[model samples]
Target: MPPVKKIVMWLVVIFLLYAIFTSPDSAADIFGSAWDVVANGVRNIGRFFDSLISRS
Candidate 1:
Protein backbone atom coordinates (compact mmCIF):
# COMPACT_ATOMS: atom_id res chain seq x y z
CA MET A 1 0.00 0.00 0.00
CA PRO A 2 0.96 3.65 -0.29
CA PRO A 3 2.59 5.38 2.69
CA VAL A 4 -0.48 7.50 3.47
CA LYS A 5 -2.85 4.55 3.34
CA LYS A 6 -0.57 2.48 5.53
CA ILE A 7 -0.38 5.24 8.12
CA VAL A 8 -4.13 5.71 8.14
CA MET A 9 -4.70 1.99 8.59
CA TRP A 10 -2.30 1.81 11.46
CA LEU A 11 -3.85 4.85 13.10
CA VAL A 12 -7.32 3.42 12.81
CA VAL A 13 -6.23 0.10 14.27
CA ILE A 14 -4.52 1.82 17.16
CA PHE A 15 -7.56 3.97 17.86
CA LEU A 16 -9.86 0.97 17.88
CA LEU A 17 -7.57 -1.01 20.16
CA TYR A 18 -7.31 1.94 22.52
CA ALA A 19 -11.04 2.36 22.64
CA ILE A 20 -11.59 -1.31 23.32
CA PHE A 21 -9.01 -1.52 26.08
CA THR A 22 -10.08 1.68 27.78
CA SER A 23 -13.81 0.97 27.91
CA PRO A 24 -14.52 -1.47 30.74
CA ASP A 25 -17.70 -2.91 29.20
CA SER A 26 -16.19 -3.21 25.73
CA ALA A 27 -13.08 -4.88 27.12
CA ALA A 28 -15.06 -7.38 29.17
CA ASP A 29 -17.46 -8.13 26.31
CA ILE A 30 -14.61 -8.72 23.89
CA PHE A 31 -12.72 -10.91 26.35
CA GLY A 32 -15.78 -12.96 27.15
CA SER A 33 -16.63 -13.47 23.49
CA ALA A 34 -13.07 -14.47 22.68
CA TRP A 35 -12.95 -16.91 25.58
CA ASP A 36 -16.23 -18.51 24.53
CA VAL A 37 -14.98 -18.96 20.97
CA VAL A 38 -11.75 -20.57 22.12
CA ALA A 39 -13.49 -22.85 24.59
CA ASN A 40 -16.03 -24.01 22.01
CA GLY A 41 -13.29 -24.57 19.43
CA VAL A 42 -11.31 -26.75 21.80
CA ARG A 43 -14.39 -28.76 22.72
CA ASN A 44 -15.26 -29.31 19.06
CA ILE A 45 -11.74 -30.43 18.24
CA GLY A 46 -11.72 -32.90 21.09
CA ARG A 47 -15.04 -34.32 19.97
CA PHE A 48 -13.77 -34.70 16.42
CA PHE A 49 -10.74 -36.64 17.58
CA ASP A 50 -12.85 -38.86 19.81
CA SER A 51 -15.12 -39.67 16.90
CA LEU A 52 -12.15 -40.44 14.67
CA ILE A 53 -10.72 -42.83 17.23
CA SER A 54 -14.04 -44.58 17.61
CA ARG A 55 -14.27 -45.10 13.86
CA SER A 56 -10.81 -46.63 13.63
Candidate 2:
Protein backbone atom coordinates (compact mmCIF):
# COMPACT_ATOMS: atom_id res chain seq x y z
CA MET A 1 0.00 0.00 0.00
CA PRO A 2 1.05 3.59 -0.60
CA PRO A 3 2.27 5.77 2.26
CA VAL A 4 -0.50 8.28 1.64
CA LYS A 5 -3.16 5.59 1.78
CA LYS A 6 -1.77 4.29 5.09
CA ILE A 7 -1.66 7.78 6.57
CA VAL A 8 -5.24 8.52 5.50
CA MET A 9 -6.47 5.22 6.89
CA TRP A 10 -4.75 5.84 10.18
CA LEU A 11 -6.28 9.29 10.37
CA VAL A 12 -9.74 7.88 9.72
CA VAL A 13 -9.26 5.23 12.42
CA ILE A 14 -8.14 7.81 14.95
CA PHE A 15 -11.05 10.08 14.13
CA LEU A 16 -13.52 7.23 14.45
CA LEU A 17 -12.09 6.23 17.81
CA TYR A 18 -12.31 9.80 19.03
CA ALA A 19 -15.87 10.18 17.84
CA ILE A 20 -16.93 6.86 19.37
CA PHE A 21 -15.31 7.62 22.68
CA THR A 22 -16.57 11.18 22.90
CA SER A 23 -20.11 10.95 21.51
CA PRO A 24 -21.31 7.49 20.60
CA ASP A 25 -24.88 8.63 20.11
CA SER A 26 -23.92 11.15 17.47
CA ALA A 27 -21.71 8.59 15.78
CA ALA A 28 -24.63 6.22 15.45
CA ASP A 29 -26.78 9.01 14.07
CA ILE A 30 -24.15 9.83 11.49
CA PHE A 31 -24.01 6.24 10.28
CA GLY A 32 -27.77 6.05 10.14
CA SER A 33 -28.02 9.24 8.10
CA ALA A 34 -25.40 7.97 5.66
CA TRP A 35 -27.26 4.70 5.26
CA ASP A 36 -30.52 6.51 4.58
CA VAL A 37 -28.90 8.59 1.87
CA VAL A 38 -27.52 5.45 0.21
CA ALA A 39 -30.83 3.65 0.46
CA ASN A 40 -32.72 6.57 -1.02
CA GLY A 41 -30.37 6.71 -3.98
CA VAL A 42 -30.78 2.98 -4.57
CA ARG A 43 -34.54 3.26 -4.45
CA ASN A 44 -34.50 6.09 -6.96
CA ILE A 45 -32.38 4.00 -9.31
CA GLY A 46 -34.77 1.08 -9.00
CA ARG A 47 -37.72 3.31 -9.78
CA PHE A 48 -35.93 4.57 -12.88
CA PHE A 49 -35.36 1.02 -14.08
CA ASP A 50 -38.96 0.09 -13.40
CA SER A 51 -40.17 3.03 -15.44
CA LEU A 52 -37.91 2.04 -18.33
CA ILE A 53 -39.21 -1.50 -18.28
CA SER A 54 -42.82 -0.31 -18.22
CA ARG A 55 -42.22 1.88 -21.25
CA SER A 56 -40.74 -1.03 -23.22
Best by lDDT: 2
Query: Per-residue lDDT for 1-56 in model 2, tens only?
Result: 69999999999999999998999999999999999999999999999999999998
Prediction 1 TM-score vs. true: 0.61
Native-referenced Cα lDDT, model 1: 0.92
- Alpha-carbon runs more than 4 Å astray in model 2: none
CA lDDT, candidate 2, residue 12: 98
User: Against the true structure, candidate 2 has what lDDT?
Assistant: 0.98
* Model 1 per-residue lDDT tens digits across residues 10-52: 9999987897878979877878999999999999999999999
**Prediction RMSDs, each to the true structure:** 3.0, 1.3
